[model samples]
Target: MRRLLAGLISLFCFTSSTYAAEVSVALAANFSAPMQKIAAAFEQDTGHKAVLSTGATGKFYAQIRHGAPFQLLLAADQTTPERLEREGLAVAGTRFTYAIGQLVLWSTEPGLVDAEGAVLRSERFTRIALADPKLAPYGAAALETLDKLGLRQQLQSKFVQGENIAQTYQFVASGNAPLGFVALSQVFADGRIREGSAWIVPAELHSPLLQDAVILKAGADNPAALALADYLRGEKARSIMQSYGYGF
Candidate 1:
């Protein structure tokens, strides 16, 4: 009789309190698609709301540095979280690599980006798009990759910069540019390429992109915040990231 009573009480408490716990997360744009899927899965399994906000990691870092009321941060580069930890902006020892992103040269037009390394040499197209290196890690990689291939000098005049990765992808997706560099996750899915053609730039061309996440200091004591940090590294979350083409 006592066991039955305890079980009934536990159920009532869970049902009554679930609506009150909500976790607020600041997410990087490159991981937005996968994060959405993780949030949905988390809520379904835990009954804790995952409120995700997406933007460029660099911009988001600025916001958090300026004391934004965010509880969690998922950065596109590991350095951001390391700085946050050292500066006391985020909880120490909570940082870890959440994903490693791949940079791709993509074009909305079919065959616009030839994988044979001929497009850079052809000089037929006048415009190329990339995220601003100052605000995006992938953008920095893009620039470096071009330089490695000895095309930066030749391509400088035709470069179009986007403020963030999403905007960079949009520049090509919207037909604003013939080709562009963007996160592979944005252009590929389900073990196959998307509508457009792309070349997944090898990691040797640029620095490794090690995305990381940390809990903000202001959120250290909040249960929701703690849960969110934990959730990002969980098995279910990792699986979603893989679907978006991000690796550990």
Candidate 2:
């Protein structure tokens, strides 16, 4: 009887361990910092691991369409996730807004970008970086802002495009471009600037960047993936996102 009972207990442990699965997430580059904190909290609270892949939302969309193994997608915009759902790549009714991103014109050099963003009119810099509008929503917002200011044509020769917001920020931070448009969350934390200079772009300059999250069809039945999605909507994850300058 003792031997039989011990074998049954071992089987139960094995089954329980198998159920504690790891979820793979494709995350937008701009949300990388805050997502790290959220992923860690998710693992601790749920006993499930979250593995992250970060890059431009466009690239992620392409990869998912081609059958990438990611179980979830945290997109930089709402459109991509909706497309995935419509195409049957994502689980239906699982999409929700996760964050609203803010765009900013930033420079690693202090005081280079004025609060009013008059520096663009000054045309003092040789090169300005922005993400490729075709690939990054923040880049689209930057382009819209430039167009609204009537500077797109004037500054056409000075534009440098990065494939994603992370690379766009790198171009300015590394001095390859004197100024660049980036996600505000990248340079701001805890209600203060973390470095250099920045001008928060007026919201009216572009459409609202509503970020969304969805469960891919591959993870529709995965407990870990479901848990991570729920955790993202919880107080802890929301607080971390707020600290990183993201709005719901």
Candidate 3:
């Protein structure tokens, strides 16, 4: 019994030291809810902590440019990561799209806006919230959908901007705004839309939301950073993401 106990102790110490590092991440707000799940699983499986910071993709770019100490970046769009790589801030050949996101016009109030977006034409609401188009990808999609339907100028006065997609969700969830555009992942449960009334914006309304992730140049030598990126592409992570309304 004593020998068995000693061996077990020896094994535990070896495993602990083997997976002791932490990986710092900059995650886009649209991905916050799912990333939380991924983070928990990642720590359990690898014993590497994931310290996450969530923000608008644009703002995160600014942070990286100014030396924010993030090891991995999961952006709502590919441009920022590509740009970072181009600017030599991220390691070359380490960039890839992690998930494809969808845009939705959502409201806590049922039937406020038809999923087809026909409600926007009626001008029934005094406020419509969205993230800043210059920041969040979902906001960009929202603006494009409105523009495609020629409601940009008509609804200009009612626009409320959030710093990121997460805040945009809060605007509607807290009734700060009656309706808003957000990532479909917000309302998705078990790979489907589970609650609230929403219009899954037609793809024709905007460009595809190809979210990307990459290892920053500052973390080029860190295996933990690469491992996190690899885990995102793994089956377990992909399953969790699918359950959250993201694709491939």
User: Which 10 residues in a row give candidate 3 its minimum summed lDDT?
Assistant: 187-196
Tens digits of per-residue lDDT for model 2 on 1-248? 99999999999989879877899999999999999999988888888999999999999999999989999999999999999999999999999998899999999899999999999999579999999999999999999999999999999899999999999999998999999999999999879878888899999999999999999999998999999999999999999999988988
Kindly report which residue pairs in candidate 3 clash with one another: none
Tell me the tens digit of each residue's lDDT in model 3 across 23-130: 889999999999999999998998788899999999999999999889899999999999999999999999999999999888988778786788888868899999
The residue pairs found clashing in candidate 1 are none
Q: How far in Å is the alpha carbon of 181 misplaced in model 1? A: 0.5
Q: How much is 119 displaced in model 1, in angstroms? A: 1.1
The better candidate by lDDT, 1 or 3, is 3
Q: Candidate 2, which segments miss by more than 4 Å at Cα? A: 1-16
Clash counts per candidate, in order, are: 0, 0, 0
TM-scores of the candidates are 0.91, 0.94, 0.94
TM-score of 3: 0.94
> Which candidate tops lDDT?
2
lDDT score for residue 94 of model 2: 95
